[model samples]
Target: MSERLKSFIRERATALGFEACRFASASAPWDAGERLAHFVGEGRHGDMGWMETTLERRAHPTAMWPEAKTAVVLGLNYGPEADPLPQMADRSAGYLSVYARGDDYHEVIKGRLKILAGQMAARTGQDVKVFVDTAPLMEKPLAQRAGLGWQGKHTNLLSRRHGNWLFLGSILTTAEIEPDAPEGEHCGSCTACLDACPTAAFPAPFQLDARRCLSYLTIEFAGPWPEEFRVATGSRIYGCDDCLAVCPWNKFASGAREARLHAREALNAPRLADLLALDDPAFRALFAKSPVKRIGRDRFVRNVLYAAGNSGDAGLVEPVGALLGDPDPVVRDAAAWALRRLEAAGLA
Candidate 1:
C-alpha cells in the first residue's frame, strides 16, 4: 500500500508538470522550531511579525491540522530560457528574479495543488490540506527531511535532478503513507552564495536576515528603505535570485517546461526609463498577472524609482522627476532621489 500510494502521487505530480515529488512524516522538527524562534527573537524576520504568532503550527504540520500523518512535498522547475544573471550586467535595466518575472506562482501552483489533492482523496478516502509558501508551514525543512532535497548553504532546497530553480509546495494527508528517504547535501565547501550577497544578509550558512534581503526590501517592506541598503540594491526592482542562480547544481536544471512560467518577451529586457513613466493605471495594466501587483501601485513605483536612480539613463530623469509632487510621500521621496542620481551621474 505504501509503495502503491507513493507511485500514485508521483504519476499525478508529473502529469501536473511538477519536476519532482517526495514524502516525509507530518511532524515538524523541534530543533527547527527552536532555531526559528531564536532567529525571530533575534529580529531576523524584520517586520514580518505574523511569523511570531504561529510558533507551534509553523513548526509542526500536525499542529495546524491534527489528522495529518504524511506530507507530500512537490517541486516545480522554473529555470530560465537563458542566463538571467547577464541581464543585471546592463546596470541601466532593472532586474527581476526569474521565478517572479511571469505570472504569480501562488495562484498557479495552488490551483494545481488543489486538483492534485482532489485526485489523492479519490484514491484514498482521507482528509488533505495544501499549502504554498503563503502558509506558515515549515516547507523547506519538511522538504529536506522528506528526501525531496537538501537545503543548501544558502538555505534554499537543492536536488541532484531539479537543482534550486524549483518552486516548493506541500500537501498534508491523514492517510497512512510511506515517506521517502531524505536527500543529502552537495554544497560541499563552496561559498559562492555567501560571497555574492550584496547586503551581506547571511551571517552564517543556512540562515538569512530578511531585514537585509532585497526581495523583502522591494516587496514586503512597507516604509522607506534604509538609506544604507539603497546603494547595494542597485537596479534590482523585484526579488533577488543571486544566491539561487549562482548554484553550480543548476547545470542539471532544464528550462521551464510550463509555458505560463516562460519569460515574457516584454519582460526579458525592459527599459527602466520606460517603467518610471507609468502611473498607477499604466502600472496595473502592465503587471496585472505579475507578483509585483501585490505590492500595489505606489509601492511598485517606489521600487521603479530606486531602479531609475541606479539606471544612469538620461531619459529616466524627467519621467522620474514628474513623480516628485505625487500624493504619496514614498513615491515623491524616491523620485527626488532618482532625480539626484541622474544629476550626480551627469546624465541630466
Candidate 2:
C-alpha cells in the first residue's frame, strides 16, 4: 500500500511539471533539531526575523502542523538559458542573480504546490497544507532525507540530473506514503563552492553565514547595509550565485520550463545609471513580474547605487547624485555615499 501511494504521489508531481518528488516521514532525522537550534542560536540567519519567529516550528513538520504525516517534497528547476557568470565582469552593467531575474519563485512555486495538494485531496480525501520557502521547515535537510537529492557542499540540494538549480516545495499531508532511502553525500573532496563565494559566506564546507550572504543582506535585511560588506557586494544588486554557478553538476540540467524565468531584456544587464533614476512608481511598474520587486524601490536603488559607487564611471554621477533628496532615507543615504565615492575617485 505504501509503495502504491509513493508511486501515485510521484506521478502527480511529474504531471504537475515538478522535476522530482520524494517522501519524508514527519519525524525529524539525525540530530536535525539540535543542529538547527545551534544554527539559529548563532544568529546565522541574519536579520530575517521570520526565521526567528518560526524557530520551534521549523525543527519538525508535525510540530508546525499537527496533522502532517507525510511530506511530499517537490523540486523545480529555474536555471537560465545562458551562463550568468560572465556578466559579473561587466562593470558597466549591474548583475542581478539569475533567480531574481525571473518571475518571483515564491508565487510560482507556491501556486503549483497548492495545485498538487488540491489534486491529492480530491483523490485521497486527505487534508494537506502547501509550503514553499515561506515556512521554517528545514527544507534542504528534509529533501536529502526524502531522497529528493543530497545536500551538496554548498548546502543546497543536488541531483545528478538537475544540479543545484532546484526550488523546493512541500505538501504536508495527513496521508502516509512509503519513503525512499536518503541520498548520500556526493561532494567528495571538491571545494569549488567554497572557493567561489565573493564574501566567503561558506566559512566551512556546508554551513553558510547568512550575514555575509548577498541574498540575505540585499533582500532580507532592510536598513543600511553593514559597512564592511559594501565593497564586497560589488555590482551584485540582488542575490549572489557564484557558488551555485561554479558547481560542475549543473552541466546536466536544462533551462527553466517557465518562460517567465528568462531574464527580462532591460534587467539582464541594467546600467547602474538606469536603476538610480527609478522612483517608486517607475520601479514598481518595471519589476512587477520580477523577483527584484521584493526589495522595493528604495532598497533596490540603494543596492544599485552601491554598485554605482563601484562602477567608477563618471556617467553615473548625475543619475546617482539625483537620489540625494529622495523620499526614502535608505536610498538618499546610499546616493550620498555613492556620489562621494564617485567624486573621490575623480569619476565625477
Candidate 3:
C-alpha cells in the first residue's frame, strides 16, 4: 500500500512539472539539527536573525510538526544553456545570478507544490503541508534523505542527474509513505567550489559561513558592505554563482524545462552604466517578476555601484558620480566609493 502511494505521489509530482520526486521518513532521527545549531552558535548566519529565532522549531521535522510522518521532496531544474562563468569577464556588464535571471522560483514552485500536496491528501486521506525556501523546513537535508541528491562540499544539494541547479520544494504529510534510500556524500576530494569562491565563504568542506558568502551579502545584507567584499563583488550586482558554476556535476545538467525559468536577455548581462541609473520605478519594472525585486531599488543600486567601481570602464563614471548626491545614504556612500575606485583605476 505504501509503495503504491509513493508511486502515485511521484507520478502526480512529475505530472506537475517536478523533475525529481522522492519520499523520506520525516520522523526519522538525523544530525542535521546539530550542524544547524553549530552554524548558528558560531554566528555564521550573519544578518539572518530569523535563523536564531526559529532555532528550536527548525531543529527537526517533528519539532516543526509532530504529525509529519513522511517528507515528499521535489526538485525543479533551472540549469542554464551554457556555462555562466565566461560572462563575468565582461566586467562592464553586471552579472545577475542564474537563479535570479528568471521569474521567481518561489512563485513557480509553491503553486505546483500546493497542487501536489492536495492530491496526496486526497489519495492517502492524510493532512499535508507544502514548503518552498521561505519556511525553515531544511528542504536540502530532507531532499538528501529522500535519495534526490547529496549535499556537496559547497553545502548546496548536488545531483548527479540535475547537478547544482535544482530548486527544492517539500510536502510533509501524516501518511507513512515508503521512504527511499538516503543519498551519501559524493564530494570526496574535489574542492572546486571552495576554490572558486571570491570571498572564501567555506571555512571547511561542507561548511559555509553566511557572513562571507557574496549571495548573502548581496541579497540579505541591507547596508553598504565592508570594503573588502565590495571589491571582491566584481561585476556581480545580484547573487553570486561562482561555486555552483564551477561544480563538475553541472556537466550532466540541461537547461530548464519550465519556460518561465528561462533567463531574460535584459538580466543576463546588463550594462553597469545602465543599471547604475535605475531609480525605484525603473528598478521595479525591470525586475517585476524576478527574485532581485525583493532587494528594492536602493539596495539594488548600491550593489550596482560596487560593480561599477570594479568595472574599470570610464563610461560608468558619470552615472556613478551622479549617485553621490542621491537620497539614500547607502547609495551615496557606494557612489563615493565607486568614484574613488574609478579614480584609482585611472578611469575617473
Candidate 4:
C-alpha cells in the first residue's frame, strides 16, 4: 500500500511539471542538525541571522512538525541554455545570476506544491504541509535522503540527471509512503567548484562561509561592503554563479524546460550604466516577479555601482556620480567609492 502511494505521488508530481520526485522518511534521525549548529556557531552564515534563530526547528522535519512521517521531495531544473561564466567577462555589463534572471522560483514552485499537497491528502487521507526555500525546514538534506541528489562540494545539491541546476521544493506529510534510497556523493577529487569561486567562500570541501559568498553579499548584506569584496564582486550585480557554472557535471545538463524559468532577454547582460540609474519605482518595475526585486532598489543599485566601478567604462562615470546625493546612505557611500575607483583607473 505504501509503495503504491509513493508511485501515485511521483506520477502526479511529474504531470504537474516536476522533473524529479522521490520520498523519504521524515522522522529518521540524521546529523544534518549538528552540522547546521556548527555552521551557525562558526558565524559562517554571515548576516542571515535566521539560521541561528531557526536552529532548533531546522534540526529535523519532526522538530518543526511532529506528525510528519514522510517527505515528498521535488526537483525542477533551471539549467541555462549555455554556460553563464563567460557572461561575466563583459565587465561593462551587469551579470545577474542565472537563477535570478528568471521568474522567482519561490512563487513558481509554491503554487504547484499546494496543488500536489492537496492531491496527496485526498489519496492518503493524511494532512500535508509544503515548503519552498523560505521556511526553516531543511529541504536540501531531505532531498538528498530522498535520492533527488546529493549535496556536492559547493554545498548545493548535484544530480547525475540535472547536474547543478535543480530548484528544490518539499511536501511534508503524515503519510508513511515508502522512501527511496539516498544518493551518494559523486564529486571525487575534483575541485572545479571550489577553485572557481572569486571570493573563496569555501573554507574546505563541502563547507561554505556565506560571509565571503557573493550571493550573500549582494542580496543579504545591507550596509556598505568591505573594500575587498567590492573589488572582488566584478560585474555581478545580483548573485554569483561561478561555483555552479564551472561544475563538470553540467556536461550532462540541458536548458530549462519551463519557459518561465528561462532568462529574460533584457536581464541577460544589462548595461551597468542603465542599472545604476534605477530609482525605487523603476527598479520595482524592471524586476517585477524577479528574485532580484527582493533586495530593493537601494541594495540593487549598490551592487550595480560596484560593478560600475570595476567596469572601467568611462561612460558610466556620470551615472555613478549622480548617485552621490541619493537618499540611502549605502548607495551614497557606494557611489563615493565607485567614483574613487573610476578616478584611480583614469576613467573619471
Whole-model Cα lDDT per candidate? Answer: 0.85, 0.83, 0.94, 0.94
**Model 2 C-alpha lDDT per residue in residues 1-348, reported as the tens digit of each score:** 778777877887888788889888865445676777777789898877777777788778877887878888899888777668899787768898888887888888887888888888887788998888877777888888888788877777888778888889988889877667888888899999989888888878878888888888888888888666777888889888888888888888789997767778888998887777888899999899777887788888888988888888889999987888898898888888888988999988
* Model 2 ranges off by over 4 Å: none
Q: Write the per-residue lDDT of candidate 3 for residues 1-348, one digit (tens) a residue.
A: 988887888898889999999999999999999999999999999989999999998999999999999999999999999999899999999999999999999999999999999888899889999999898788899999999999999999999999999999999999998899999988789999999999999999999999999999999999889999999999998999999999998989999999999999999899988888888999999999999999899999999999999989999889998999999999999999999999998997
Off by over 4 Å in 4: none
For model 1, the run of ten residues with the poorest summed lDDT: 27-36
lDDT digits (tens) for residues 175-257 of candidate 4: 88888999999999999999999999999999999999999999999999999999999999998999998998999999999
lDDT accuracy of residue 18 in candidate 4: 95
The candidate with the higher lDDT, 2 or 4, is: 4
Measured with C-alpha atoms, the lDDT of residue 159 in candidate 1 is 79
Q: What is the per-residue lDDT of model 1 for residues 21-112, given as tens digits with 9 covering 90 to 100? A: 88998864446778888888899988888898877677678778878899999998888866688788787677888987788888779998
TM-score for every candidate vs. truth? Answer: 0.97, 0.95, 0.99, 0.99
Error of 4 at 253 (Å): 0.6
